[model samples]
Target: MPADRDVLLSARDLHKAYQLGRVDVSVLRGASLEVGRGEFLAVMGRSGSGKSTLLHVIGALDPPDRGSVTLDGQDVFRMPPRGRERIRNRDIGFVFQFYHLLPELNLLENVLVPGMVGRSLTAWVRQRRGLRRKAIELLEKLGLEHRLQHRPRELSGGERQRVAIARALLNEPRLLLADEPTGNLDRASGKAILDHLVELNDGGQTIVMVTHDADVAALAHRCVHLKEGQVTSRHDPRDAERPVQSVSRR
Candidate 1:
């Protein structure tokens, strides 16, 4: 809702399906949305609602069967693999329901993994150091500064999830995609993670979070509900639906 922010990500009539054996399982049935810079938006849905599939499509990890996804005005699926890799590496950050940290690496090393893939050692070192600093800062913010050297196996569930958040922040991405970020945490820890996400949003991070928690969705400036692979409703929940305008595609 900030007046000065720019639209950062947009999806138009996105559809995704999987062919299993002889049958087609349609997941995302024409879901469209626009996310602006410095905005916090949440997608709420139950299990099998296709919210995570929609996030994966939007993140460019998987392509949609139909429609288009544009990030910062660039068509995601239209780009070459190398180009998409560059964008996925440098422009977008992802957080998952499961803490996907590598058990072999420590927190700092895990956070710097993205830097190791596409850049030269010199260039990597330059960004790596800066990103490392940011990672440490994020860990401190998440109350995990003491666990910097711990491996994923050594940390608690909440601590591991905090490391995932730090890893996602390593790229200073233009857009952050969180798929059920707090789904694995306890009630109090989930609230803590949500609070940290809100703090990041306050610091001008553009976040698109997929959550089933109504309280978590309420933290966002806007909330969109998805059911049966389509957006069913969108509103502020606290305000009249007339004032809470939203776009529905498909």
Candidate 2:
């Protein structure tokens, strides 16, 4: 860890729960963490270990019942509705296990959705050409240029995942949150996706990935486990009891 390491995201004492029928299931219990700029960190745990819940809270998609999440020093949950939405759109990118692509839209059109967001009809029209160019370049980078006109239903699982990655990157967000990006694909396709993530991280993109596979977690610069709602480093016994784990690139 560098002395000058910049912390881009901070979650302090986070707590979240869900009501399942008559039961209240607590997922995150005082979980906290810090992610540095230009770092690729992986959160690992067992099934239903609240890894996805942690990502959702970090990305500002779900608000925690207790504690605060700050991105770039701004408290996300404390912001206004529009402010939080802006951060989600412009500062964060998300890639899910299911590659949530629009089945009705082509690859290019789907990638353009982020750019079209928060823009008026006239504004979108003025920016469409440039946004289209960027989207194509992203598709080309992801090896999906030839499938630009292809719909999600027509493409293979890997191809759809690539397209979804391109869409998440359309806005050039500062943070990329991936939840089980390789869980649905075979080993080869999953390796390809992880390779892309490694390349992106090498280029200084910050990423927080959640996975249960230790092999997948090994690809990141650092790995932290979510146990009892708190992040702990298996490599460091001291971190096992700490509530807040500030992980930095090794």
Candidate 3:
């Protein structure tokens, strides 16, 4: 973490485990991390390294067996279920490897799901226009305007992922959490998604991504590697002097 940057999210001494049949498999052990505001941080590791678990913990999707997470000075685990849900809906947006767009909903409607989650029928009716406009704008920004009415099954892998990204940005979340966002795409498609993420980060959207690909991780400002549930190394792709303009192909 940089000394001059403001910390937007922090986790300390995190520990988690799961019960698999009759055995307990420990995942995270004393993991700690701090994400600065407007910073693009990448978490990288091999399969079963607990990278996904770490992201879920910080994003409040799953609770850690022990340790604490603070987001923008508020204790996340300490909040009630409703409060945590609010924070998840209002402050954080998530993108995953699999585009989880609803099969029955069109791209635009899927993007609007988060906004409609807790609203009453009357409230939704009143706010529908504005929300629809925002969703359209986001889809356009992601180059998916023409596909707004198309269902997920009608789109390609890359296009569906782009739609997922658009949906994540619809709420103008303070933080974006992406887990293996390009794992399901080809090299070119993956590069395009990473480029979009870079553009968003340059425009002041904070992001934390988990990826196994080193090439993808290079796009981030800083990256931390995990091994056997513990942070093993941290590095800046720019070598600590100045930031690089873009990721290099290798």
Candidate 4:
């Protein structure tokens, strides 16, 4: 893993466009990005800047209009639909602004959903016991061990989000994609969640997150700024001061 850790994900000239009444509305226009293994990357942009679209494209949930996305050196778009789904199930985990937990299922059951996608109950139960154990461990790490038996309605927003994070990590994925993960929470809860993400990164989990908040973006090692469907700037906060000098020259 360490030998191949230099590049976990790479995107080149990525483009995504949608049709709206005979017009092609481009969402991602020649965006390029690379994420090293165990690196935490933040993407920031205003609404309509295509940040979320880029995340979805990278995750294989949506295909780009053009360009290539490679994960672990395999071309993501070259795969068939079923192949793509399989890759998503086996290697990618996703979190969103809304905790998309099932209302009727308890936390353990909810966390097991991804593993249950194409299996019988007995098989799922048998195969996913280890996953369940990992989920419990993740929840314990996120301070949600006591809430495992609770339903989504019974938990607060932050608790539900924590559960969602635990669910995302259940598969031990290499890439964790979060789209505005803290958009619905208060500042303190958001901060805590950000810290949790940082902890995961510190433990060698690769993450790509889309955040509208600059403070949250600052937590990542690098920030890719998007505008007009293109990646306009990339800021490494460690060298953030250099940009100030460049701007002053202008």
TM-score (C-alpha) between model 3 and the true structure: 0.92
The per-model lDDT (C-alpha) reads 0.82, 0.88, 0.86, 0.83
Candidate 4, 1-250: lDDT as tens digits: 1244599998889988989999999888899888889888888887777888999999988889899999999898998877788778778999999999999999888888887875668978788767778878888999988888889999888888988998888878889999999999999999889989988988999999998777777788777777767775555444222331221110
Candidates in order, TM-scores: namely: 0.89, 0.92, 0.92, 0.89
Steric clashes per prediction: 0, 0, 0, 0
At residue 246, candidate 2 shows an lDDT of 39
* Residue range with the least summed lDDT across 10 consecutive positions in model 4: 241-250
- Estimate, for each residue in 1-250, the C-alpha lDDT of model 2 and write its tens digit: 3123499999999999999999999999998888899889988887888999999999999999999999888999998999999999989999999998888999999999999887779989998999999999999999998988888999989888999899999989999999999999999999999999999999999999998776777778888889878887664433233332334334
- Model 3: CA > 4 A from native: 235-250
Cα RMSD, model 3: 4.1
| Least accurate 10 contiguous residues by lDDT in model 2 | 237-246
How does candidate 3 score on lDDT? Answer: 0.86
